[model samples]
Target: MNLKESEPTASASLSRRKFIAGTGLLLAGATLKLQANPLVSGAPLSTLFAEPIIDIHQHTDYMGRTTDQLIAHQRAMGITKTILLPSGRPVNSASTHFGVGNGLQAKATGNTICYGLAKKYPKEFLFGANEVPDVPEAIEEIERYLKLGACVIGESKFGVECDSPEMQKIYELAQAYNVPVLMHWQYGMYNYGLERFHKMLEKYPKVNFIGHSQTWWANIDKNHLDQKVLYPKTKVTPGGLTDQLLSNYENIYGDFGAGSGLGSMTRDEDHARIFIEKHQDKLLFGSDCTDITGHIDNCLGAKIIAEVRKLSPTKKIERKILYHNAKKLFRL
Candidate 1:
């Protein structure tokens, strides 16, 4: 027997490697398809997913994720375009409040990384500029990114009063840049003072204000008791503060992202449908999840998509919330 006949050639070995790699990707994709079926039901979350989504809010280096993982996560969700919102420069000294948990901190995830990623993956990404609102140079830094073509102005998830002078400056920048501002409105934590936030909304009428987080969502219940309650499971009272803001203020919009966003929608299905139809034009779909696979026992973003689909009265309304609203607001 000739050894050459028995031994695998270099081309054969290369072919085998390619085949194995392809198989792994196929397996992963198949698993995702199965998981997505329950959420999307009729179809899987492929690049051709029904919504043609544009994720208005996402982060780079989120929760210690690698760059490839970050891209993979967005691609897995079938997001048509994504806006990467970087954190402002972290303070050198400790402050009264730095937010809860690892993901909530005001770290210095700068505009450079976001710019680089957006530049490198223009088809997949666009970025937003942000800076620590209280800092003296905050407006200057934010302006720099805005001039550099940041499509949006936040993830303003800092430990400052929502209507503070510092936050006002950021909102002013939004007006100047002619871009929307996405605020993370937690009650006692980040972006404090939801009740007074109306003042800023009034002050910055020309600027589109996108609200996210627990406090903003929880306000959908008129009988909401605690300011710090992240998720309110009570029956929605038809016309809550959130409803009013979305109704009365033309500039105000909702970001259906993260646990808070999903909680607000799913907390009451009946109300969610009404809210979905009524405010279809004012809502934007954003997956603020840090999950790389975009599939889990409970991926907040996927669940929100499902909820919106389930609750939206018409296909047009569902499309508006899922992507059209974000596209028009962000000018993507």
Candidate 2:
């Protein structure tokens, strides 16, 4: 074959490679429609069959960016939908509770812009209202979102244990609404462990709890740790915490989002290979891309997803973590 004729066969070979390397869990009956040019400036596209993503966690400025920009960015990244939470400062090491007044100050007018986004882009964006237990009228505020069709509650930032009486009440409300509650779990600030989260799991039984941040997914060893070097380093080993939690609790799941989630997957590629293989069904893909103006381009969530996809040679496992697990969890 001459060079010109050989080019056609070579191009076809490359396209086949692209499709073969793409995300396998291509939704129910969805097929990949490859663009003529799958290469975006030398970086390969995830795959032509990349499953549509439903980001379970994302944040935006209350009075910040235009929804158009948010929607466009999400679409560009293959995110078909996302759950939006109000941005709150991390207080102490525990959860940053947001009351009605607090939400207002944070510029998250409960029924303002976010509500509009949900109404306008019902398919691509979901609104999750934040409720701080310390506020007496928190329940009422929660009802407002429920009435408006908010499916989940919180990106609850806490520095305390999940079993606190205040947290119990939040779980109760979640059960009442029949929705899952999302919590940010990290080691440093005010950290809590699997035992604490498990306590709540035991108490509520009915409330579905989804955990995020590094502390939640670090898979730390519950047996022992040198407390001195725990902070940042996090005394736990990979596949430790998640393995136990998924095995013990039926309703609990972890969000692979933010620095912690990305850190866990990248810190040790070998461990990640084993961890994802075992707990693939228990992990949900999310990116803590809450702030609109910061770190959007720099966020490596897409890369992390691609990296995790490579851990296993087969696409079955990747499909589970990328979308199926989350789809079944969120009932989307």
In the range 263-294, model 1's lDDT, one tens digit per residue, is 88777888898888888899999888877777
Candidate 2 C-alpha RMSD relative to the actual structure: 10.2
**Pairs clashing within candidate 1:** none
Top candidate when judged by TM-score against the true structure: 1
Estimate, for each residue in 68-120, the C-alpha lDDT of model 2 and write its tens digit: 55664565556767888753322222244323334423444343456677877
For residue 63, model 1's alpha carbon misses the true position, in angstroms, by 1.1
For each candidate, what TM-score against the reference? 0.82, 0.72
RMSD of each: 7.9, 10.2
As a TM-score, model 2 comes out at 0.72
Candidate with top lDDT is 1
